[model samples]
Every structure is written in structure tokens, then in C-alpha cells.
Target: MSKIIDLIKAKEEGSKPFISIEFFPPRTADGVKNLYARMDRMKESINPLFSDVTWGAGGSTAELTLDIAEQLSTTGHVANMHMTCTNLEKGGDPKAAVRGALETAKKNGINNIVALRGDPAAGQEEWKAADGGFTCALDLVEYMTENFGSEFGISVAGYPEGHPNAISEVEDPSSMSEAEKARSSMEGGKVYTCRDADYKKEMDYLKKKIDAGADFIITQMFFDTKVFGTFVKDCKTWGINCPVVPGLMCINAYAGFVKMTGFCKTRVPAELRAKMDSIKDDPDAVKAFGIEFGIQMCQDLTEIGVEVLHFYTLNLEKTTYGILKGLGYEVKGSAWARVGDQVKTANGVGVVKSIESDGSASIEFEGETPTATFKKEEYSKVF
Candidate 1:
């Protein structure tokens, strides 16, 4: 097991940038199972440097998140589990659940964590700190370093466009400073941006997270590369010297694009938004545009000295794969068959029962036919 920061530092400067992917836990058993298959397939294909699972609000999916993180670690991917300070007051000890989670992560070989001040729990209109709980990600970072003492590498979030909660509508766009304008977004004829003061506070808080113990930063998604570039420059101006990984959200559908950007209050460049609006009715066109746009955005990031591209996969595969393939990354389609997968053989259809080393597997046929082992070339995975 290795820390994600270590893996990153071990890479020689000016080499190909590393690929990292993020996944969120699905809400159902079947969805979870299919996600496992998809994850394994992506691991085989793109070979991400690290994979992370998002934590649900208020520990709602805490156990499931840990399980998925462990699975990722054991299956040859560096697993970065997200830990949040929300609704963790149990037995009057606010840190009890968090402490237990850290212990579990240590035992499971999850060497990195994304410390966060999480969103509100279900039915809560706003976020509030539990009694004796952390108030922000900076506090969580301090706690981890204090308790674990460098046992785990920590990364905190950076809001290139300011966090959604801090972003507000600009009553007079002309009054805004150039920096504020760069971080601003517009919707329905209203301009929105993090006012200069609030953006300074955001940057100060992010710097505190780094000083407290965070090794790196992963930013919230934004469509405009110039916004991200300016944010990076601002980070240096604020004396934040940590690595800031760009979080790229792969566009897969028109509705999802609108919903996510609206929710995050992300600044969508006018041209990109107009193109998306024009092609909103065509799903294939939307995905194709998504891939094409993602390619250009990634190239822009690379030119600006970003060493890693962290993709928010949204628990889907197509757009992410398409973008990578467009960027000249080797994407090996699923070549390994898993147990219980349907396969086609000369004899007929069968279910894979076991896979052996040296490129062979055993198949169990239907209707009283005998089970048989066949060379890898004799059968092909059908699903």
C-alpha cells in the first residue's frame, strides 16, 4: 500500500500526467454490484493512479463507502476514502465515529483520505456542526494529523469558482473586479460570483487546511479553463504551495449537465452552454460533444502545468472512456471474463464458473450438460 501523494511525487517531472477517477456509491444493491463490475473494468482499461469513493452526507453511507474503499485498495488501486464532519455525534462524543472510521481505514490499507466539511443530512436545510464536532475541513485535517500523526495522507477541497454556498448574485456586474468576474457565472440573465472578500476567505481557509496537514487539493469542477488557471495563480498569491488537482466532471447527458452546474453554481462558458443547449435533445450528440469538449479542456489544463486529471465519473463509463481515448490514452476494453458472466463457446452458451491463471476458464453449461474447462481462445465473454 502507498500514499497517493507518494505515488504522485515518485513520478518524474514532465512525464505523462496521472489519471485518477472518483466514484460515488449507488443507492441499491444491484447498482452497487454493477458498479463493482464497472470499476474492475475501468481498472483494467484505464489503470487509474488512484480511485476514490464519495462519502454520503452525515454518514448515511459510511459503511458502504468504507467497504468500497477497501475493495479498491485490495484490488490494486490506491483508495482515497472521503471522511466528513457531519452528524457524527454518537454517544455524546462527536469524534467517535470519525475515530472509528480512521481505524477501519488503517486496517484496510486505505492510505489516503479527503477531509471535508460535509453537506447537510437529509431534510436539513443548512449545515450545522454537531456538538463538539468539526466546523470545517481545516479542523478535520488538524484532527487527523493530531490523532494519526501522518499515518494517512490527507487532501482537502479547493473551490476554483468559490464554493456554491459562498457564491452570490452580482446585482451590478460592472462593479465587479476583474478577479471576481473571472470566477463568476451567469444564469437566467443574472450574474453570480464569489465576491472578492469571500473569495479571499475561501482561499485563506484552503491555505489553513494545507497548513493543518493536507498534502494536496482537489478542486470543485468548473467548465472554463481560464477560471481554473486564474484560481491556480491566486493560490500561489495566497501562499498555498500544495498540489491542486483539477476535478473534471465528464459530461454524459444534457439534463445531468444542467442539473450539476446549476447545483454547483459552476461557470459554464457561454459558447459551451450555447452548444449544449442547441444539442440538448440529442443524447448521442450530447455525449459526443461532451467527449470533444472534455478533450480540449484537459489539454488546456496540461499546458498550464497540471500534473493530474481527476475525473468525476458519475458512476458511469462512456464519457470518461471516450475522453481518455480522444486524449491518446490506451483504453483496453474489458478483456478479462469474470465468474458468473455469460460466455459464447462452440458448444453453445454457458456461464463462467471459475477462471484459472494461464488464460483459461471453466464453464458450466445448461440443461444437464457437463462442466468443462477450455483454453482462453476457445471461448469469448459475451457479457
Candidate 2:
């Protein structure tokens, strides 16, 4: 019943920071059931401001994404469904499938979407938009605004280190700017970064997405907190004045760290890399280091005034819990009913206008209220 953007804006200035979680569809039925259980437990423990379901490469998991999103929205989580441009079919209305997906999400009462230009299909070397179809995320944002109006709160991807396609190999790291050098990644003895020109284009494109009615941005993962801080300042320079949620990809294992950073060309601090290399052989040590490093990075982000810490859970939870607990957050109990929480009470359905120290909540019903105070037992969290 609540849009993700509304919930974000509803946060009082100087309030405690919140969390959001991202999940991908599991390949098996049993895997999905287990993921659902994990999500339910996560909600009860450390309630996230919103939950995200990724659209697989080439929209391969479209149906599953819709199903999971519906479940999350109906079960008291604000579901942010990712939609992409990879659903085009040959010689047909290129946006037919995309339109269908949007319709389904709206019908299911899911009001948030992450519009993206998705990764290419399996076995494809480069991404290509089908002829007569949308070419990029900007197009998708415009399409949604044109079709759905303000019915959905739309978000778009922001790459702190720039998109992988825009990042290119460089022989001379010496010539790169301080900002570029800090974000440079290495692969096969070569250094790579989004050159200044491409980084500007990325920023301009992001600004256009916002202009086209996208409500917020969820950034791609980066290890260095400075990289994210610089990106936020740069957004202001580019006139992108919206919430930019930093994506925190939890480092749970060494191999995943190596593989994903290499694949995305993500920047890793030299000391962080050396520490990981030293501890790579010890699984428990690697996980322990991940939590330790995550806490430090999160502390830096909080100092920079970020409102939300968005975790790419990768369908796992332990490391995330460890990091939150390290930060002195409660990781094992139900959160108090918050200002933006939607609830159904004996009086009627409404958002919580406020909450008392004793767990009493004031409910604000549509077209009705001198907001009424209700005890914890009189109302339950609603979709």
C-alpha cells in the first residue's frame, strides 16, 4: 500500500538509518521455498525498508521475479521489482513482454520498480537492443512514466564505478584522475576504469532517468566507501537530487569476491585485497574478515549521511546479520511499528502516523482521522 519513495521521504531528518535487502530467484522450487522462509525471518528480525527481486539476465527469471515480488508485497514488505529491456522477441512488438510484466506488478499491488538495461543473454558477448525496442534504462523509465503515470515509484541503477561496458582497459594508470584511479580494477595484469568521458555520459544518462520520472537510484556494489561518497557528491554536481541508495554486496567467501569483482571490474582497495589473499585458504577467516571489513565500510557510509544501507544478500543472511550486530543494531527481534508501516486495525487500514514509547501507534486512515492510537495487539502490519 506504500510506495518505496514515500517511505524513504517519510524518514525524519536525523533518525536512525534503515536497511533494504535484495534477493535473486533461486533455480529450484525447494530453494525458493527456503528463500521465502529466510525472507520472513529477516523481516521479523531486522525489518528492511524494502525488499528487491532481481530480474535475471535477458529477463530469464521474469515469471519467478513477479511471483516473489507479489509474495513480498502481500506479506508486508515493500517490493521493488526490477524490470529490464532484455525481454524483446523476434519480429514482434518488442515491448509486449515488458508491458505484460508491468501490468502484472501493478495488479499485484506492488508499487515500486527498478528499471534497468539488463545483462545480455547467456552465450552473448555483447548486449543488443532488439530493433524497434527500447535501447536503455532511460527509455524504460520514460515508457513507465508515459504508461503508468505516477502509479509506480520507479528507480534506476547507478554505477559508482561506472557500468562494466563503459569501463575499459588502460595501460597507464598514471594518467587517470584521482577519482578514476581510486575506482580502477585489475584483471589479467591490466587496469580498468570508466574514463572521465564515459563517467560523464553515465551521469548524464542517470540524470535523464530521474527527469523521466524515476524516483530514486540503487547503486551497483563497490567496496570502497570513498568511491560511494564521491559518487553522491558527483550526483549533486550533475543535478541528480534524489535518494541514492548504496548497494552493499556482502563478502561472504573468497572465490565469490574474486569472481564477482573481476566480472564487474569493481575496484578493491589494495590492503583489502592483500588481506583477502592472505586469508583465502581459511573459510571461517574469510567470512570473519568480511564482517569486520563490512562494519568499517558501513561506519564510513553513515558518517557521509547515507539514510539506507542496501545489502545485496545473494540469498544468504549470516554475514549481513553479523555486520548489523557489529554496528550495535538489534538483529534478532521484531522492529517497532514505524512511521511508514501500513497496518490493518479494527478501525480500518492506515499508515502509522506515530508511535509512543510504550508501543502504542497512532493510525492515520484515508479520509478519516484525528489519528487514533492503537495498542500493539489492536493492529497488525498489512500489505
Candidate 3:
């Protein structure tokens, strides 16, 4: 498998923009079938160098993530499975959960990982480290490095607009009388107030992870491209020269966009929000606006010379295809096409085809029935 770190370094050394796509673990048999179908349709337009499959909250989707990663590897594209320390123990103990995930990835030849401290489970009290589990993402990276050595290329998360948990504190206490001060002094006069930690804390944590063997960085999605630009500049100031790829999400539906942002704690710029609100009730208009907005944002970022753009695909191929086509991409047919039936296109092409249960397709091309199996990398070359 091609190491993600090597790929990022290659991009830094004059390679064209490296593009990738991300997907969440499928929840059911039908979901998995649907995802494979979409991957087939998108194999052409988004020839992702590597794809990432997220580990569900509370370690629910760990197995599914590995399964999907294995499938992607079979397609000859690297797959990165996300590993988190959200429920891991605080002290230095081998987290069975993480260990099992790493073992699965190794067995499946899925050598890429994105280490993180995943969000708490729905309605959970707070983020509590599991007994005998690691406490943070850095600890997970350290463990992976020590266990896997150079076998795995690791990626970590970066937040551009700042993490939601981050907050600034102000100290403003009125003067107290001598008697009251004397009493307070007896009870430990130091006042502790909650305040926002400096941005440097997050950066320092990221750097520590890198020092511990993180290969690349994928940032949280942001609507404002300027926020991403400033984030890149700050990374330079902090001496983090590793590839810091920006994550993009195309919000085609108003409700879906709102739900995703709410869950991710990401902001939608006021102007973009206004634009969506203007056509909130009109599905067609909202989709058109979303595609146009995403295309323009991508064009702007491309002009500025970003090393890579990663899309968070929520398993909706039509919308993803529309956004990519808007940004000038050529998509291949679904996973149904046979090997010999694959065709190349110069400009943007989007195809939606049917797939049978046996993972094969028979179609009439110029009065001949040709069969083809789905291949994902063929689409990347056209792009």
C-alpha cells in the first residue's frame, strides 16, 4: 500500500493537488450495498488517492470501518480507518479496542489511520476515558507508532475555527475588605475561574502528536475559506510543515447541512446561511445554490494552491457528483461496469447505472453486451 505520509510529502514536492474522499461506516446490509453503489458511480470523478472511513461514536462502528477499509484496499486505493481514544483509559495501558482495530487494519493491508478523540456518545454525561484505555489522541498515536513502527501512516485532526470546547475566560473580581480577605486567605485565597485556553495549546498538542509520529493532518470542515487560510499561516508560524489538508463538505440540502453542522460544531458563514435560508423551502434552489457555492469556494482554494482537498461524502452520490461536475470533474460509471467496458472521458462526466447482486453488469455498448467489474482508480486518472 502507498503510505499516506509519502503521498503528502510527494505533494509538497511539486505534485498536483492531492484529493481524497471520506465516508462514514455503513450501518446495515442495505447501507453497505448503497455505499458500494455510490462508490462505483464516483470512482470516475473522484479518483481519491486514499479514502477514510470513520469509526462511529462509542466504538460502535469499528468493525464496519475496518471492513470498508479492506474493501477499498481491494480496489487498489489506500483506506484510512479512524481510531479514537474517547473511551480509552488515562494511564499507559494497551487499549484493547484500539489494539483490535490496528490488528484488523494490519491483517486487511489497510495501513493508514486517522487517530482522534471522538465525540461522546449521544446523551452521554461527558467524555470519560475507558478503564485501561488511553486518555487522548496523542497517546493513541504514541501507541500506534510503538506497535506498528513505520508500517502505518497516521493522520490527526486539526480545528481551524477552534474546538467548541475551547473558551476564553475573563477575571474581574471586586476588591474585598481586609477582614474578608483575611478569611479568604485562611480558606486558600486563590480564585480559580474557567477561561479559554490559548490557541497555542491546541497547536502544541498537534505538534506533540506529530513528534510522536503523525504523518498528515485533516482539518475540521469550515465554511469560510479565510479561516482555513489563516489556519495554514498559523501552522507555518508554529513550524508545522506537514501537509495540513482542508476538509470540505457540500451541503446540498438545508436540513442535512443544519444537522451535520450541529453535530460537528462547525459554523456556516452568515452569507452562506442567508443564501440557504433564502431558498430553504425550495429543494431545487437550495441544491443549485449549494453546488455553485462549493464550486466557487473550491476554485478560490485551488487558485491559492492548496495541496489537497478532501470531501466528506455523506453517501449521496448525486449531490457529490453535481458538486464535482460543477468544479469540472469526470465521473465513471457505478460499480456495475466490467473491466473491458470502462471508458475514458476528457471533460466532466457523471453516470448512474444499475448493479446486480453478483457485482457485475451487462450493458449494450454499440450493439454489444459487455460486462465489467467496478474499479475505483480508473476515475482518478481522468481527473
Clashes of each: 0, 0, 20
**Candidate 3 worst ten-residue window by lDDT:** 179-188
Query: What TM-score would candidate 2 get against the native?
Result: 0.86
What is the descending TM-score order? Answer: 1, 2, 3
Per-residue alpha-carbon lDDT of candidate 3 for residues 1-383, written as tens digits (9 for 90 to 100): 78887876676544456778888877789999878766645554467877888888876676677788888888766787888885433244447657866887898898889998887765785776777777889999999999879888999999875654552222433454322221111112232221224456877888898889998789988787776777788788888888888888877789998777655556566677678778999997887777787777787777667878788877665556666667666554444343343333222232324435644433223323332333443322111
Candidate 1 residue lDDT tens string, 318-353: 778778878888776434667887777887989889
Name the Cα RMSD for model 2.
11.0
Q: Which scores better on lDDT, 1 or 3?
A: 1
Local lDDT at 352 for model 2: 89
Q: In candidate 3, residue 179 scores what lDDT?
A: 21
By TM-score, the best candidate is 1
Query: Candidate 3: how many backbone clashes?
Result: 20
TM, every model = 0.87, 0.86, 0.78
Instruction: Select the stronger candidate by TM-score from 2 and 3.
Output: 2
Better of 1 and 2 by lDDT: 1
Worst 10 residues of 2 by lDDT: 329-338
